[model samples]
Target: MNIGIIGAGTLGMTLGYRLSQAGHRVTVLETGAQIGGLATWFDYGDFTWDKYYHVILRQDEQLLSLIDDLGISPRMQWKETKTGFLWRGKLVSMSNNWEFLRFPVLSFPDKARLALGILYIQRVNDAGPLERVTAAKWLTRVFGRRVFERIWEPLLLSKYGVLYDRVPAVIMWATIRRYYKTRSKGDGKETLGYLGGGLKTLFEALERGIIEAGGSVETGAAVTEILAGEAPGVAVRVGDEIRWFDRVISTAPSKVLDRLAPETKLGAVSASSAPNYLGVVCLALVLKRPLSPFYVTNLIERGMPFTGVIEVSALTGTDEMEGNHLVMLPRYDEPDSAWFERPESEVATEFLHALRRVIPDIESNVERFFVHRAKHVQALWIKEPPKEQGPRHTADGRIWSVNAEMAGRDTLNNNAIVQVANAAAQAIGAMGAPAKAPTAAASRGR
Candidate 1:
């Protein structure tokens, strides 16, 4: 089978490796110069690390299995990470039961409701009902109005921005459940894992496996059009070059794939009425010292520009970064938001100014700063439940949609991505794609 995978991110390369091992000629295409997508590495002057903060959780079975398969499990580093929450201009630890119980913002009734709600939702097998309800409504009902106003709403604003009010409760349920399940045993503190060289190591390993298995991974090769003509195969155009493929598996955002391959109508995959994705703009900084004792600090300060603070070096360690701390201030919003259009220096300055409220002496400890942005981070499902819980083969049955929208009730983590990759591999293996022959999919392979 001559398989063309659009986007050379973790999912695309994983698919490429699987199909190539199955004896298919695979080609992975990426628009950017780099491969890993959001998980790609960057040069931070003294060191290179993941552009965005990523960590392996204790409960990330799929990701762990992939790492083990890559023969890099021995290089895995694990640590008990602390979590903090800011409220009323004060930073407080909330990683344990005692700290949570001592959290003053919540009344006894509020605490009780919050506890019971969490206990109930943890056992929920289906997220359909949650998706029908908005997060604001669900939180207010389960955790009380005071808790919603004081803690949840502000926290939600950081991630969802303008869409917070319309976001489904299932997302919040899934996110909290994912986070809590990762808590290490005994002390209840979450244990996070990191590779020796970070996510770049994992991505590179996947890329290598694809190439070694006779597949090709091409970067800076933006696939502009995919035409499933009246002919036998799909014709893909990269610049002026048009090539035929037995089957096309697009890991692109739903909307993007629709534009690339309009032949499918793609309604079964993503409709025109579907919600737009929430993009991320992160203001990353290297510091001479750690900003906080906790790796993640959930922000609630009303005027803070960014949502939360991630002390990535706390989990990754300063050893790989010349003993300098790496922290990221990320804002999640619409891709075309005014903030995204603003100057990078202006965004950095605003974020830094607000950060001082949490860390009074931050400027003195800062070493270097960088800005990273991604337009399609994850689909933002608002008000209504998604029509289909998983990606479907388009009407033509030639293009497979394996994107984030297919991840039912799960957070956008590497584990979920690996699960999607494995599922797609199994499904495609059952299909009767064209016989394995010349590598038309990667005719211009690097």
Candidate 2:
């Protein structure tokens, strides 16, 4: 089969590599000059970093398998990672069992109840019919209003904006399970791994494998339209040229599908179900000092703009760049928010101000600062217009539609690469082709 994959991000690359390995000809069309989409890296003079910070957990089987398949396992190093919460001006270390008991933020009884609730959630395979339960209500029932307000409430608001109230409890359960199941020994510290250079290294290897396996990859190619082919194929118009394929798999956002195939019923599938995506303004600082020892610092202040701050060097255990520190200030807003329209300089200044408020020494230690903005970084899965309204995998004869929501619903983690492979493989089989089975040798990372 000749397959054309739209959007050469992690999803596109992985699916293309697998299909090519399965004796199918695959071609990937990428809108960006470089690959990896959200997980792509940007060169910072002496070093390269992801456009947005990304780390893999121990249970990220899909990602880990891909790394080994490409013979990059030696480059993958695992480290026990720590995460903390900044609640009501207090820095609370909440990464371990002992820390939960020792922390002064919650009363002893409140802490016990919270701990028990987390343990219960972990043991239960099912999310307990949480589809009807809102995150705030469920959390308050288990952890009390104080913990909800001081910890979870603010984080949800910062990530979802006004839609926070509508989030289902199942979403929180999925997040907690992913973290709890991946925890390294020694309390609740979770093990995370990073590629030798960056995520881009893994992406590059995958792209090369696809090309070597009788596949083609083209970047800066935009598919303007999706039209039905003369026979059993799909035609995509990239600039002035039109290309035909036995099947077409789109890893592009579902919203893009709605725009391209408006005449087909495929557009309406996810039109009303477009979950809001929060924009992230990442600030890379060549700092004189580190912010904190913890990798992630979750802040909970109502008026504060930034939701989470990640110190890259502290997390990686390597200070490759002199005065090296990369801080990510993620702020949630609608796709069309005023922040997106503002100049990058203004965004940088705002981030610096917010960052300095939390880390006082940051002002004097900073030597260089660069900012990158990701519009619609993640799908607002937990919130409005509710989970039932989310995008469903629909086919209008030839065109296939998929995005974060579809991936999250079908797979364990809505990871970019995994989603692409799962969605594309499903699309291909649905198009009258023999079901492509996962090669055991390939799955074993041989």
Candidate 3:
């Protein structure tokens, strides 16, 4: 079988590797200058690291397994990281029971309730009922109104904005469960893992494995159109040339597919509606000194610009970063938000001002700064069993759409993307011969 996979991100590349290993010929097309998609990296004069903030928890079995298979497990390192919360203009530690007990934001009774609520959520093996409820309703009911308003509400508002009320409870449940499962039994502290050289090492290994398996990986190959081929396969137009394959798997966003193949009945699978995505404007800084003792600091203050402060240097050693701190300030908002239209200089200045409120002396410690923006970093999941639920295969089972937005009941992360791609490969392999490629006459009939 000959397979053509569009968008050479983690999902696309992983799917390509899996199918090629199954004795199929594969060709991966990517629009970007490099692979890895959201997991891609940027070279800072001194060192290269992920463009966006990313961390691996001990509970990420699927991601860990993939790294092990790629022979990069030894290069991975684990660190006992701490978490903090900024409330009432104070940065307080919340990584352990002691710190949490002393947390001044919530009363003692409220803290107990918060702990019990997390325990209950962790024990919840089935999240079906939770899906029917919104995070606002479910959390307020479980942790009470005070705790919800003080702790969770601000965090949700920061990440989801106006869509905060529509976010399903399953999303929150999955988040708590993932972190809870990663805590060490002895100290009950969270431990995070990172690769020696970062995600670059892992992505390079996947690309090399695909080529070694007789598959071709092409970057900067923007796919303009996807049409029916002359035979029982799909044809993809990359640049000016059109190439046909026995199968096509698109890891691009659903909107891209809607534009390329409007005749196809995508139904609810298409993300052509408003409030479907959450964009991110991230500011990463290479600093001469560390910002905070914790790896993550959730801001509870209202009207703050960025969501949280992710000090990547806390989990990663400074030696690898060329003796500089790596900090990322990410703000999630609607794709059409006025923030996206702001110039980089304006965004940086505003972000720096807000950041100073958390780290009072951060201005002088900065060595270099860079900004990155993504229009569709996260998919808003207000609907139960997302419109594009289940395997990537469409109704006709010829073309497949696999991307982070399609991840149901799971957060959009590298591990979940790999899981989705693995499942897509199985479904595509089990299906019958590819459907007849759409010819001009056949396209008109639809």
In terms of TM-score, the best-performing candidate is 3
- Clashing pairs in model 3? 228-438
Task: Show the colliding residue pairs in model 1.
Answer: none
Which stretches of model 1 miss by more than 4 angstroms?
267-269, 383-387, 394-396, 435-446
Task: Please give, for residues 45-128, the per-residue lDDT of candidate 1 as tens digits.
Answer: 999999999988878898888888878789899988888887777778888777778877778788878778877878877877
Give per-residue CA lDDT, model 3, range 1-446, as digits (tens): 77889988888988888888778778999999999898898997799999887888777788899899999999999998999888877888888778778889989999999989988887889888997999999999999999999999998998788788999998999888887887776666888989888898888988888899888999999988888544576778888787777778888777777776666645234554422788998889999988888899898988778888899999997988989899998999888998888998888889999878767888898898988899888877677654546555556666777777767767768888888888888888888565554343532223
Point out where model 2 deviates above 4 Å. 88-90, 319-323, 382-397, 409-420, 426-446
lDDT for each residue of candidate 2 in 304-345, tens digit (9 for 90 to 100): 766677777766765544446766667766777777778877
Backbone clashes in model 2, listed as residue pairs:
none
Candidate 3 differs from the real structure by a C-alpha RMSD in angstroms, to one decimal, of 3.5
Q: What's the candidate order when arranged by decreasing lDDT?
A: 3, 1, 2
Score each candidate by Cα lDDT: 0.81, 0.70, 0.83
**Residue range with the least summed lDDT across 10 consecutive positions in model 2:** 437-446
Q: What CA RMSD would you report for each candidate?
A: 2.6, 5.7, 3.5
Best by lDDT: 3
Clashes of each: 0, 0, 1
Ordering by TM-score: 3, 1, 2
